[model samples]
Target: MASFHLEEDEIEKGEETMGSEPEVDEDPSSSSATWGPPHQHGRRRVNNYSGGAVGLNINEAPHVNKDSTPFCVFMLYFARIIRLLVEETNRYYHQYLDELQDGPSPRPDMTDSEMFLFLGIIIQMGHDIRDRLKDYWSTAEQFAMPFYSNTMKRDRFLHILRFLHFADNNTETDRNADSYDRLWKIQTIFNTLNDAYEKYYNPSKHLAIDEIIVKFKGRVVFRQYIPKKHKRFGIKIFKICDATGYTYDMKVYLGKDRTRADQDVTATHATVRGLCRCIEGVGHKLYMDYFFSSPDLFEELMTKDITCCGTVRPNRKGLPDDFRRRQFRLKKGDIRVRVRWNFTALVWKDKRDVYILTNMHCPPAEGSFCDEHGNAIKPAIVADYNKHMGYVNKADRMANSYSISRRTWKWTNKLFFHFLDMTILNSFILLSSCDAKLSHREFHLALVRNMLEHAARGPPRPQRSRGRPPAVSSAISRLEEASRHHWPTSSTSRLRCRVLFV
Candidate 1:
């Protein structure tokens, strides 16, 4: 194994010594951190944002206002959102009336306070899931949850949900037009939240682009089926997140992108580019996996003043012929490197072969790093990837743990609830800056409780029916009111009730 490693390095050294390598097509840039040879353009050589840089310099250190509450922080992102929802929801309700001259309009038009009460219930529902939506309204002692029945009538709550709408029924744009949107049903909500996501907070220098799946099994045209993902079947969203696990931007993947067919870039390249637009032309370090990384993509991004590093597939185009070979084996901690115009393509051996490509760190390929308690570890690039690459995944994991998602066959419901969770999660993240010790669950409970409290104080709550209340069980009836219990006077009775004196 050692001989093989030595022979591989020697062969590469001999080529350089003999000057047998082909010269690059472009002149080297005058930049100080220039690697290998000159490139086509004077692109980024290091990751740093010049205060003089004029683009998206949102190198953010986010903080919540010291005087703010969770509701205030949430409203900061969703105030306009809730208002838009109320307007559209009421519009849709009235539209239904005009269409059917509908029988008694499903429980009066939704109001601002009522809509909030509805949202409060939805948020609370995500905290604890039951068998069915109706279960929340159950009046049985074992299944009773007063928050649901007390805030609003079961029928009224379901009425608002049934007519819940975002886009107007009459305002849908033409499908035949080139600007058609596949997700028009929730497009407004998607864009509104997405904008708020970026507008409120800017990420630090380290950003990662990766795919996130919202678990869905409904029959939708754009639903993705990735067997390897925990959500094996769902909608796929490509998000560029900060090192802090905040989603800075996202692109919902619909089938084949017709928009990219006219462009020279691959779908993955375009996805990464679209997600990175806010951070482009700024010397922010991007990280992704091999599926999104390639020599062309890396260099293209470099030209835009962004430097990225990721694990590369040996078979990817522009990788040297030797890297594409999977036949050979190497001892642990062995490495083979090929440098091309600020990009370093590396093959390091550990439990198995690992390939990496980057225009960032150019670590010595002779030996592995021993940064962990004197034990050998992977190289610098691997260490950095491990540190920053899981931010998106962490965000997903956190959201899923207390997701407000409910069972639904409607694609509209799935998309709406999923993004709703995203909004809550992002709001919680912002609030954390103010109270660093707050947990997501605690923040969520506090936020929902605050909303419910407001709803409780708002106009009179829905009253129970005017008839006799539902019958109580014998056990509950006996324990509540003090009553005289006359036992049958029988000597044959073996069981007796006796009060113990304390």
Candidate 2:
């Protein structure tokens, strides 16, 4: 319940007074201030406590170009992943058709090449599938041809949609399962992409964990209503991303069962633990929002050699009573610091109280920032958290900007397209990290172009040359001779007589 206040005199003196206090716990097991050995030699250490900067600097980060071909970076990383999805989809589609009893094949079967084109069309044309298909069939433009072949009809594409499934039919199992348990439909695909994501890139320090909502109004039991979100109703996904918006890991939120408890684990703690499981013992520092930050979670991360930083809600358990109490007397730049056995909680009063919790940072000797008025101060931990916490949000914004997802009655289809968008977004992040100088739109365009070009059957045909019309040699000679020989009496009659004679 105790808290230590930082006075203006102490701030002006630039003294490190918080470390001297007995309340600041020095337990090696719980304190994140203590340094540990590097996770691996030559591994780039993310912001460490010596006031090291967090996240990547755009100018100084390493440049790695895996392939020189346009969109080769995307293909190199995601080609196999896409192929797997297509194969699974086709397998399930055929199985579904064969199982049908009443109708004459519920839908037509699709080939891998056709499926690739379908996805490419989605990337190239961000519209309703039917409208895009209509345009593809009706337009005279060359760009439209690569997206949908001249031979392909709109009905065929619709058939593909009708039969698309990521998993096999198991009505018995599905019917017996809970309504929220339908995530098994696409679980394999999700696992495949996740594995590829982690294996392809090693995340830098300063990772962020946050939720992403894929907007949907479909009939589903697990549909969430987050009024604050732009799309209030959708399926929720928890994501852990790095500084450049590269998703290192993700977990779909099904319901309360998404978190499994061993003893006294909270949902927030369990979610963080699940997302960060792969990166444990690697000395990575994770940043999250108040929803996931807690004293016990920070302690848990510290044990695994990971550092944690985030804003904490005041009402959360384990927050000191003094820290929680409303402060009307505190000025704009006033600060408070409370160091527990496991984590440090900082309260800086700017326009309002901004509370920060971290196992990675300690109280600053001199608060490192000034507001526009030059009178208000900001904490370094606050600044650092603000800088890195937006990575997941950045990923979300980029994905949603030119989303290829369409309005669908089926939540599963919406979820599938959402996955596709995330896949492309992740590829963009990876490519940009490797020094590919392209925006998200450019990356997607290049991917579409590459896929279409590669799948093309043959080179485009050449246009035939148009030569001059055959010369009227005989007629010209006759006309010249007639003109030389004849000076007619009546001009019109003479011309007619000369023509007849010629």
Candidate 3:
């Protein structure tokens, strides 16, 4: 091998003398013992040849100064938004507690206040936080974005308080933070959200129920209860989403105990009933999955004048196959009575062939209404019911197909993160309610495109000086002048482009 070593003095002298010569490529066959070139191979070089003060004597210099600004101003704005929301929520919660208990300030230290506030904000904003980010940050921030919303935040805070035994274990509990416990804080956020749904949205006839699974830190091993199927730990989240996609109610059923009794079915039912009581109407509907279906529970809902719609399992033997076929019959107006549907079937539990059970009865309408594919449809309500059932079946299938490992925190975070992702999807649904012209999925796509465009068109940076820096006022003046010349023309061009695209 050829001797490649060079003295420090020789290298410095070579740099000085060879300054004017074109920079040579790094040697390709350097031994593995040597570090790779400082820069990547086959890359263009940045020439900072402007040696004099305030002027470039040569033609080339680095394209832009790296330190002038953050890579994403959009992300900064989102962080600011998260901060603002947390501060505001804490203010409201503390105020509410103050009125009820006649107490002094809940949390005194500013740092403690901020940390809990962040926890509350993340859970309350659950998934909705991601929506705000979709319009600003790239996919990286989206992945890191917290699962929180106004309701979930409050719920988590309360759950933490309950776990610490700082307050009464009731819906209207007012206990605040006692100490700094991380897991307590996390659990409180979820539990409080569940209570909020019971208090505000559950009783109303307009609420619907869904379940979410939140992964945890370690494997759930149980001696008394049924050990969780996968070693991975998770909390089963029961959410009551209103027609608008906002969570009115929730329950964080710890997944460690898989026994039928420990699942807290009674508490979950009571919470659902509590939510239903909030709505001021004679007839309301509560949508659920097959897991919640029971003879007594269905009868209880019927007695309360609240209708329940969900999948009835195959082995549910009270109603026969012949009865189901007869019940599926359609009728015409005047002669047609609004009979409840008894949707129970033994077909495979997949997206394409899942069954829906409802108490409402109706005559099937075939030709009057058509699906998107122009196929003759059943009654409009029946079609809607079918779509909803299809979505639940699909979600269940997707959840089953995927499994997370328990070996790392990254895996745990990833599972919970995916569960929180529904908040963005739900927000898109809410936006669609405001403007019927767009679907939630379509709105998300548009926002993503806009965000990418903004990121690619990164902000311009200020130039660095060799000697004394320019005065602040002088720099401001230059920026103002640039703006005056640039903004109006840019705005007009953008408008023209939008018009053409439309």
* Best candidate, TM-score: 1
Off by over 4 Å in 3: 1-187, 196-206, 215-217, 221-234, 255-282, 321-355, 363-381, 387-502
Question: Model 1 lDDT vs. the true structure?
Answer: 0.69
For residues 1-502, could you state the per-residue lDDT of candidate 1 as single tens digits?
Answer: 1211111111121110000112245532433323332223223333457323221223432335544566767776677878788889889877776565214423455667787888888988887789888989998887898878888789888888888888886778887776778888888888888888887775777788877777889898889776544567888788888766678899888777655554666778777777877777657888887768888788778777788888777887677667776654666667666666566777777656788887777544554544345434666666777787777877787777778787777777777887777777887777664445677888888888778766667676444344433234543455454453553455345343333321
TM-score of every model?
A: 0.78, 0.72, 0.36
Give the range of the ten consecutive residues with the poorest summed lDDT in model 2: 13-22
Error of 2 at 385 (Å): 1.3
Residue lDDT tens for model 2, 87-144 = 6667876676456433342333355566666777778665334454466666565434
Using TM-score, rank the candidates from best to worst: 1, 2, 3
Q: After superposition, how far is residue 180 of candidate 1 from its true place, in Å?
A: 1.8
C-alpha lDDT values of all predictions:
0.69, 0.65, 0.37
lDDT of 3 at 9: 17
